[model samples]
Target: MATFIKIVGSLIETLQKILIQGEIDEYENDKQMHCDARLVEMLDRLSKDVQASVKFSESFLIEKIQFLEEVKGIRLPLFIPHSVFLRLLKKKINSVSEFPIKFVNNVWGYLETVCAKVLIDQCGNYPKLLPSMKKATEHVMSKMKAKFAERVVEMIEMEKITDYTCDPDFISSYNKLMNYHAQFLNLLTSYMSNSITVEGYGSINIRHLSEVPENTRNQAFDLKMMMTTYWKIVLKRMVDFLALQLRFFIQKVVKK
Candidate 1:
């Protein structure tokens, strides 16, 4: 896991370097043209590398799960070990996949930071880049929706109401279920809060907008609005899903 994180960190660093160094040259001369071409090429290469790294990480995690299930004979439908769950909870979200929310958040953070730097450096000159940036943001939000769906499924499967009566083991399982639900809700709430905060720029970056020209402020505001909408929509969907799950659990408990 340490090695995987180090690899991801290295990829993010490379992406940062590419974004910083790939500045558009002002001169229209042949030398400037060559430099611009080279920078574009480098950016493309770095983007591909980052995508590949994310894919590799996802595959590694899946493989790890498969190993546990196949080799160790661990059943997926049963409750996950507390230690394993703790380790999973520690993972930072990635932008690429739905399984590890923290890694998704980290990836989005890096992308937004670099894209904001580019926007500031270019002073809103690069309209072409806006679509790509928006797409990446959208992709992360979509993955978040999928992540919530996955959580709902996992929670449902883990829930076993054989006897909701006062059996000691059943009581312990019920407590565990409640605890996991609370933990997930807390995680989602924290993610939403941080996302809208000034630091994360999951919403509008007022400071960044101030740095740009007045004409570009509208564009920046629009981008902010779009991001804010996505966040709200995804969060609402997650909340609704959790509520439904809670309703079912409550019904089961009451009936039993």
Candidate 2:
């Protein structure tokens, strides 16, 4: 019986190590902030086997999820319900350590991809407005890159807290990374503005084209009026409508 108990304990320990290393490897590969808290929780939980330590670690993870719930104003999915996760961990259930790690990692990956796409799409449309989009792009990209760099540093420190060997070179690279990212942002913004100005100026050289052709003038004016009405009624209203929808979704999913 003692040997059997030891064998079970050994299995659990091995599982914990696998989860920790997998998490660290994923974070290193992705450098996203969303996974940072989850990794810390796993690391802390594995570093100690005491019941209280597990509880504390689990609670920390839950608190982060709660914060995400609040920030995005969206509830977590039902497959990984918050209450269920807490109850499972509190009861010392360990079957799904790998599951939680994988689920959260995938969720974060999706978020990162989508957010980046939104930024890029916005950037793509910047050429239409020239300097405004250029400045906004520069501002947003710098803020984003700095935020990412800060997150990477924080994750590296968190790894060290869990007794992982952090690469000093990685931390040192942050400064160079910041400069390069800023330069890239600036270059892209300038290039976009120049391209748009050239294209727009070229289009303007044809007097008939610069002014709407006589035949289509009325149609063009009508189209503009339609757009104005749409913007006033629909497009403008969607901004807060979406926010409220998001908040409602969050309340429904997380309130219980």
Candidate 3:
């Protein structure tokens, strides 16, 4: 019974090591959940920065309209060309795809700096080990950054193909944006008008958009609203996802 008890205790300890500390190293320890407060503060700031700043290209409107007009095909009345729309959507995605990767790089770059400081502070007692530890950290961060960047590209491609979300906000947001359709047209047609007030978007010059051909305007309006709504959803999800990735990364780094 004593022997069995020791065996069970040994097994539990081994499992703890595997599940908690993972592969032990200079950085790994039993407290898997431990993370520096600086990381938390940095992550919060990053989330706000991404949410506030990232958006689809403003020029996408003119570019897409031109492309659509160029690709405009003979079609039955009121039936939009799904293929053309898909291609246009892919183009928009491609244009905005780099933003996520850039954010990822910035995040990882900041993380590397913070982590280097951490190593310096923690391992100041052992100056000889700092070089190797810092090197390992950089190597790990680089690999993780590449992996994340690749995933972001894959995500953009997948979004290009199709997107589905159960969020009622999708429909709500689309309807709200489309509510401006008549107003948008009115503003555009008003020869004396310099700008139009758009909800969420502050007063903006319509002079440039006003020049879009009348024949193409309707489709352009619809496409713009749809893509705008989708971009909002995509950006929200990207931030949420990056937040999760940040946590996973911090935990993984801690475990290392």
Cα lDDT tens digits, model 2, 152-198, are 33432332223222445433433332333333234334453211111
Best by TM-score: 3
Name the TM-score of candidate 1: 0.20
Q: Report per-prediction Cα RMSD to one decimal.
A: 26.0, 28.9, 7.7
In candidate 3 the C-alpha lDDT for residue 65 amounts to: 73
**Alpha-carbon local distance difference test for all models:** 0.36, 0.33, 0.64
| Candidate 3 weakest ten by summed lDDT | 30-39
Root-mean-square deviation of Cα positions for candidate 2 versus the true structure, in angstroms: 28.9
Q: How well does each candidate superpose onto the true structure, as a TM-score? A: 0.20, 0.21, 0.67
Q: Global lDDT for candidate 3?
A: 0.64
The C-alpha stretches of model 2 lying farther than 4 A from their native spots are: 1-206, 210-215
Query: Which window of ten consecutive residues has the lowest lDDT sum in model 1?
Result: 53-62
Q: Which candidate tops lDDT?
A: 3
lDDT of 2 at 191: 52
- Rank the models by TM-score, top first: 3, 2, 1
